[model samples]
Target: MNRLVKTALLAGAAWTALSGVALAQNAQPASQEQEATSLGEVVVTARRRAEALQDVPVAVTAVTAQQLENRGSADITELARSTPSLTLNSARGSNSTLISFIRGVGQQDPLWGFDPGVGLYIDDVYVARPQAAVLDIFDVERIEVLRGPQGTLYGRNTIGGAIKYVTRRIGDEPSMQVQGAYGSYDQIDVLANVSAPVSDTLGVSVGIARYLRNGYGTNLTTGNDHYNKDVTAARASVEWTPSDSLFFRVAADWVQDDSNARHGHREFAPILDSAYDTRAGAGDDNHVETRGISLTGEWAVSDTLTLKSITAYRDGTTRGNIDFDNLAGPILDIPAMYDDDQFSQEFQALFEGDNWSGVAGVFYMDATASGAFDTVVGLANLTTLTAGSVDTKSWSVFGDFTYDFTDQLSVSVGGRYTSDEKTGTVFRQQYLGIRSPTFGNAAATLLGSPRTNYTRTREFEEFTPRASVSYKITPDLTTYASWGRGFKSGGFDMRGDAVLYPNTVDGYDPETVETIELGLKGTLFDRFSFATAVFDSSYEDQQITTQYPAGATVASVVDNVGSSSIRGWEFEGSLRATDNLVINGMLSYIDAEFDEFLAYIPTGPLNSTCPTAVGCFVDVSSARNFQNTPEWTGAISATWTHWFADGSEIAFTPSAAYRGAYQQFETPAPLLDQESYWMYDASVVWTGADDRLTIGFHGKNLSDERYKTGGYSFPGALTGDSLIAFYGAPRTFTARVGYKF
Candidate 1:
């Protein structure tokens, strides 16, 4: 059978198995209860059953809708800002796909074969492809960010971590809300949501959001400033309850985004010399279009059993000329890079009562993509390359069970056996064959090879398991411990133009993480709550995919020799000092390094002439701390609200963060030591119209800290030559209006 057909068959088989399991679950026994309070000891579906967060014994952080809005975080990147134990990395720039690292592990390459280390799920359905994840969060019930390797329970995208955006489902209500905001940098955002019942057994909800912003940097050439973006999204859902025992809901969404970059840089001067590089110039645009639909069903066959099924599909396209340099560096131009990922997935399982529950199901996913690239030097073309298609299929069977030894003590265990098949073919007709470049001959070679043709296929079967134990020592306190395995798949590197090494197919090795962690979750004085955890994780065969040489078209890959471990501690607490005074804070620290890293310079241009190549592979025999990982990162926030004798209220919230400096590349000199930065953000709100409306004025970055929040250096481009960093957004003011009925 053809590879694609085989992949499809396996995927279908997994889903079919899940469907049968769900059917069986519908025929078992169940549990029903009234919804719990927002900040109480709520249960998490991540474990395949409803268990209190403190009772799960896993490293997880949950954020509510109110908190998200208060922080003005609309998308994944923004969400990562406040999320502890997490950091965001990018290959292209600001608008590029996000690579999230939890406990310092993740993939940073934006290639056809490399998938994100972190997984994003909506409801119980997995959003299988990365491109489809570009959509923003509009109306959400809550967001749960799970750290550590979730291999056993969450499966595939959970190799590093998992992010579940649980949207607000149809509740017992009829309501409507509208909100709008205008901000500095010529920003505007509008949102509206409406929910109602069509019949006693049916209901529907609809939401829409529009966002736009003008450039924050000047377009040296167009004089027509850019770097601004505009996005519009719409979501609608229909829910039906045929009887007290059955429920079904389906949702669909659409989004389109268009934006450009104000590619700027610091030359000898930031004013007169606009360092205009065509590749980084304003004529280029980065854009994406997305469409997604999903369906969910719930059936209570008996008082003791409940069955659930979740299915989702997404189709998307991304096109952009991601500029490498800001006219201030040697990074080359990446023009017309195109990508598309079509995803389809389904999950099914059964649930028993809260005291004892077991869930068994299968997961399947298929992702395919193709891309093109045009590399030029100073508007004059150097190489025109094309990359072929890549197809990936992943399937797994997973099960989780929890047994309550007593009302206060229980143990839960889950495991997943996964099989992954990947196939890719990159052809470079002329590009790969060029030896001595004669302008005419090189162009001819490039056209012939188009690019070097590389076809690779790899398959892996892995078993990951997790077990946890929790105990309620007291009514207000709970403590637990857990351990699990997580893994990232291996893939071939992207070789667009005729790279320095035509045979350099630095295939990655799957990174493995084994975590042992303990934590405490407690509520004190009836007005304060906190959770603290300390963990040690060992990473084997670490895949370093972000270390591309400066000016190189592809990222450099390396594997750890001995083994690496990361140990860290995290503590978060919130105090309601009074009815009108509240304070919250979080602190995190991590220590990560290579037990041993046997580095070697392959026979390539990178090892041929840097500082005479005297110490080409010198570090291979030693151990060193991992580069680019901050040792300490945390934040503190406080907000207070006061009411006058009248019907109006005002509030103030201030936030701050601290991050330790780190070097990007493992270089002796020319290091990019990203200095630590501290920032403050605050907002004030006023309400009127008998509490039906609210108007607010807010200013983020109250102290316009001019610092680089993120960055990386490419090795192929030469150390420090193409080093780039994303500067923190400048302080801005915003005004908002909202109404509810």
Candidate 2:
């Protein structure tokens, strides 16, 4: 910890010295200057109002549309490569489901009963499920990532952090843009957007996109593609300004993914020719569909006050098959279906006075998530069917206010009171054949009575608070300190088997976190800008998910692990060395450890002490670690622009990112964990003088690094080994052309 503090101080000193030198070199008479070049100011809505990024007391990172384009980012997962203290990837066996974590806090299980530690929002509309949360990047204005708790002002309370995707709005004049791309693996992409004024008081916009790509490897058993992409998406929006004081906007979006089921590589088996290749015998067809609609209205009641309302509805469905063993037989196969729907409403009022500013809001949400899966065990000649559903009704009231005592000093405080109700229904049964009768196997017969058939309800209430103090040493430099609390509700385990574990009927407890942070954000000289923060958090009652052998099958359960402590530091900076050259970089480090962990330990043979045995509790704090929490993450990138004699412009960008080795689960498994790795990406773009024609070429993972992102393991559950691992994308390149009219 001392070493980290010293490093941060040294880095700050170095940046100050460099900025001083640059400023001295550039100083000159204003009358003699022909043109001025400086870093642009960034505006963010982190505090429920538009403000300069450097002036805000919270820690946030904003990525603009041009930045995303330069990096060739396709979806939300790619943002992790450049963002600090963020880990994002696709969940096991699915390509569209997202698993995300920030600062050592997040959720890996995409089940119905569990709540995500990190919140995902699109234009202020909260997404309630992870099933289709890996949104594609197109027609977007910007993305904001808040690092700490966001309980006040946000519709949904998030403990780890929050990610907001802001889309482009309708313009005043008619416009059209079309882009096409061709890449490695026969990848083809088309995107089109159009906007026009319908009347003097209304404007409309529409966008459509199609993305297709060949698989990185082949499925030897099914003769189908593996790790492929096939998606179609569309969005429409209407904006109306009836009067100078009133405004309204309605937006709707839809997405469908028809990609084949992604199969993993068996780590205990012989190495295949390609990391993406598999011999799974499950069906190849997989589908995911998601849609949402939102309406927002704002009224400027007076010069010092404004009223706003937001109403939204969203739904998604996923159907897929997973071959856990990656073998020809159905040793460990799962056929699953998931459905989720949500409706949310929020109202807010803003106040701006001479020395104070504040926002008060009330929010309500009604949501339901249901899923079912059949686990087929051919080696045991039996199957287990697990079906469950969870309904959530939540309401909250929040407010945040800031007061300026003087021009250089300010104080802010905020709080949120939330009430959450969760009702869950679970059913588990055994079947006689290789497949379950519910999965269309008519010959299969029931083995016995239902293992678990019951419904449970739980209610949770919490009051989270936040406070911060800020001081400005100069107009361009500011320092701040803040404290905040966050919460995540808990519910019943969907795959619980009461017959094996009698306590499975009782659900886990909610998790909470208290964090304290100190930060600095400012522009040194006009050419350099930076932001840094150091934080520590106390996490309590963590909900840990684990799989255990139950009779002849495996049951998934969630327990309240004792507690943990997490500390980390983040640094992000950008330097404009020359008029046309810019350099950007970020570095972060996290130290997360369990303070206490009470784990159940078996004392006898599997069958002797299995169902009726009372296990002993053991403190395994020293043996367990946090999942998907890398210790060191860093990235560096540079962009250089050149102008030709014909007035055309071309830009070149090159970047690289590094991530330290980390465990995928609490219990470390060598075969399922990923090692330290680096990824390299580069892009070159050219634009015509008119700024209407553009061409770009991008290359990702140039070194062809093969690394694990997620996996599954169930030891002793089946006769053969069931250790499977999923890999990220291999080397790929693309060429693109775009035009605007």
Candidate 3:
């Protein structure tokens, strides 16, 4: 074994032994136990079956309710900052633009066919849209973060692993908790959770949370409010347990976000803009409404077999402006209204015998998103162009099985065959600077179809695969290697060329990743545990989008070309420093490149007077880096809890993180550079009598680092060079409180 692996093994063994001894007296944190910070076992279902974190052979990280609360973590973006082999970001202060990458492979585009690189599951139900996965944590049991490509199980999108938010179930006891907080920028949060038994056969629980914040940036031009973010959401669930072998739960959730939206992060200069910005602007009006219902059924068929089924439906509608401009109000136009409806269904049969365990299941998901949006093309006069509806569907059958041939050896294999179909039609495609004869005809002769755009993609399939093996050589340590393949479906890019060119162009084929990982998982010291892994992933058929010239207008579309690869390492561990002190940390590094890529020249010198400009773009660059992906990410946190002689409880957490630089475009111009920066966070918590009352002080962005987040720009066919970029957020803080009964 390598020296690093040997050292890691030795440390893990020592920590486990030490932790066990201290658990007898110390109150340390445990994720699966009923108590807080107590050395207890944590149960996880990432492998399609329940297993202890220590016993599971895969690389995984989990945070319990206590840890999350102590860290003051409430959203997926924050959760990503605390985990290894994970990278998270939001563009324009909207969860709709969430980007998550694992081992340096991820999808950042919000398009019809391109799926999210990471899978987000709440209570075992897959979330449909990226926006729906906001993941507000309340009454949560634990959050399991599985790293690597999980193409073998848990359905599709599992390529970059998955995040499972396990919530508190309806138990036999009645419980209640209420919390409220107020902080800088007029930020306010209120939350409540209550649980009760309806009868001997039924149990019910309800949770509600409200978050509000006033504008943080002052607009110098229009005196408008900017940086205003708010959300109000609630959830209710009912559990039914009639027999010893069967259990069922039904849940409903709703969320409404109301805030005056300003322009997204705008760029003042190249390589100088961060993604998060608090700029003041005019035309501040943006809002969203989302609601969903889900039902889950679990049955223990026998001591060795179990069955699970999950079904859900969700709806969302949004209005107001999406992009804010620095130019005239012409740059400040509102998007046509848009609504989204999605449905998901899944079933799995799992078996766990003495030497064999596996799960088999089928999953189906579909979403239809239709929105109205306007585009600008004139130089002196502002023209508003409109676009209309889009839809898509996907389904798959997947399974995985593992068997132990002996006490020290085990092997597992898994795969999924997924099929996807998508279609869309533009009702009122506007040619901002030109005249149009027709808009709805996808087949209009390049001469008459100017009013509408029609595009359709159908019947695409992906076959993802997974394999792994593990061996326990000693009582305290185990080593393993895994191989998995991930897939991302290809579809239309709505923002590419704008309305002139319809989407009828062929959407690119799906992309794939072949990842191989090796790692060790162990516990030692009676007080510590650790996991480390190294991976190499090869990617193929990368996607690219560009503007296509059609007569007097520009129509943008997407296509796939070339290949690439990436290599990375990840390690994480936790220590019970003392009876009252806990320390945990994670680190990751990725080296990514374009082994092969096709970059099309987006624009060329054109007549400045023409309202519509287009050039015959050519593939000028090959094998280029992808967009919005960084190479390294790491985080560390320490939490210390203490009890007063008078019986009051107090806890504190200090945490920090850093993300390495990466390129903004597949073939970046001289103006673009990779992002490299770090951030810090900390929280202080107090517990009152019988843990009924609690007050907490929390602060985020302690580092106050300035960075750029999303979007890209290139030279236009017209006179102006395409200068598109957004600024990231600056350091901010807030204080919060909660009560329990």
Candidate 4:
């Protein structure tokens, strides 16, 4: 008893035998409008106003587009596996290198002046580097997810929350849709969209997607197959309302990712036997490309005021290789590249009165980034190459306010003021005895020196605030309380901090948070629905990075390392339970820690708790918490639909998700935790009867389970084989077809 409570009581008896076989096949019955008495009104814009996700008071999770194509979610780590406090990873094998953690903050080294406590947007712009934030959930029309601090109306690094990606517009009439899928390794997916109406006020739309696969490990020394996939994406939009107070919208997008390389495996061995025979003798590959454009305008200035504007530009590039000693020679190798560009602008003014309403905004951004990397050590080839360039500029002003002293009470307030500036330039090179020439001048006089250039600059400012209160006790319930503040900014650490002093390249400061929440949202008897939230956050100057051991190579630094806290809760529910059953559930709990950290511990044993021997920074703050956070997460689903008698319909969905043990770096070595897992997914569909042909089948994990979403640690003094990890994806199935016009 007590092996994590007997594996959570055998995963709660396999979720009660899968919810008693989906409530005994929906226990028959009929009518009553197919039992759905409530749980419909979702609509959200989180607070850029468009309410009703139970009248928003924060804590969101939208997810639409038919629930992301019925859970076959295309990207962003498959919509973070149905969002149970979201956690995603793709780093190393670059699916555009995404690494997102929510509720426990984010940014786990997409390295380039790290920043990203979860915030990514599209439509409200803002998607500044995580190597251009792993988008690709094409044509989406929903995906809100605003969990904790969204700094006074989504401004800056949202302290662990914010993800919008609302697309799908431009429509007046005509339409077309197409989809295709095939699976299990020969995988392929395709999608298309079209919309029409070109005058009488204009409208247009276009979308496309492509995904190809064939790779699940098999690099037994360059026989190729290190996570293969070639991705493609596209989008376009246009809309104009030539009158009725003017309006306009324009959009553009593009993405590409040609993959291979990201099969780190090597879980302790010279060549273990599992991860499908992983070896990758360095013929690695990875590529990424992105493009963007946006424009929006609106004016109505009189039916209760309104004015808006948005402009954007984005660019990206990333190239890679990271066989990082997964064995097969070349000691430890890593090849990297990155390039970036950004531009932004925003303006807003909104109003409504009767008791008040609000919105106000102004924003500006500029960016540029550059990268280079090469690190190969040992085997008589010690080389290092590092390069950097960064430039950033920012500005902001924001506001949000709401009042309604009656009609069920309300209160809201928001504020934001930000400023940021960053600049950097760096370069370094080292090579010793690259083929002997008198041992290359005595190993370049003991490991090269001289080809160091530096420049750094920084500036930052912040003012974040938010407040909320709500009540509506019955009109279908609602209750709320909130407070917020969050900011993240501070840069420079493009490696080069060999203990500061003259090795120059320092600057690590801003990281702040403050949050409090309490919530409830409801609807009951009308067939049930619920939501709950509880949070407490605090953190300050909490930026920490370490990778010490430099002499035989390995250096990464960044500091501020102290202070942290988090407490959480979330509960969600739904039920219809008959007339064709429906049930949904979610539960999450977090307890992140590190209330005063002291970093430096990437692998152990260097006695004396020394101040140095090669590395040592102790105080691991009671040892671990917060890193891909998962203090019990859960999800459940059940759906069924059936109708016939010529009108066609068939649907079935079964889902399960669970995560408990977690840790993927915050240095807790032992292959970096990640246990307690469970995943199962299923789907089925068939339609026709004027629904414009459809068919489907999907399966995932389905109990095959073998997990680890990420990990890295090469100790044995830098790879003589020591922990590499990164596996997730096994058991898959797919089949699909669709059409409409």
Name the best candidate (by lDDT): 2
| Descending-lDDT candidate ranking | 2, 4, 3, 1
Q: Considering lDDT, which of the candidate structures 3 and 4 is the better prediction for this target?
A: 4
**Superposition TM-score, candidate 1 onto the true structure:** 0.85
Model 1 scores a C-alpha lDDT of: 0.64
- Which 10 residues in a row give candidate 3 its minimum summed lDDT? 433-442
Name the regions of candidate 1 deviating beyond 4 angstroms: 1-39, 89-91, 132-137, 262-279, 328-331, 378-381, 384-386, 429-451, 496-506, 546-562, 603-628, 644-648, 664-672, 687-691, 709-721
Residue-level lDDT for 251 in candidate 3: 92
**Residue 716 error, candidate 1, Å:** 9.7
Compose the digit string of candidate 4's lDDT tens values, residues 149-175. 787788778888888888888767889
By TM-score, the best candidate is 2
lDDT of candidate 1 over 1-741, digit per residue (tens): 242343344334433543353233212111122112223466576676665676667777888776766666657655555667777543435353565677776655556666677877776766655653644658788888888889987776576788888888877788898999899988899999999888898999999999888766665555544446578888899999999999999998888777664343432212233222222452456677777788888888887777777777777777765444545332354555546655555565676776888788887878777775544333222344545677878888988888889988989888899888877776543342212142223433443434456777878778899888888877767777787898777655655332434433445556678887777676655555667777778788765542444232443434444567677777676666556766777767777777766554544344434333322343442434555467887888877777777857777777887767654443422334466777677767776638678887777777877655444444333222344455546788889888877
Q: Give the poorly placed runs of model 3, Cα more than 4 Å off.
A: 1-40, 93-97, 111-114, 269-282, 332-336, 378-390, 426-428, 431-448, 495-504, 545-555, 602-623, 669-675, 712-728
What digit string (tens of lDDT, one per residue) describes model 2 on residues 662-682? 998988999889999999999
Clash counts for all predictions: 35, 0, 46, 0
> TM-scores of the models, in the given order?
0.85, 0.95, 0.86, 0.35
What is the per-residue lDDT of model 3 for residues 442-528, given as tens digits with 9 covering 90 to 100? Answer: 332232344555566556788888888988766556678777887776666554443343333444677777877777666554456
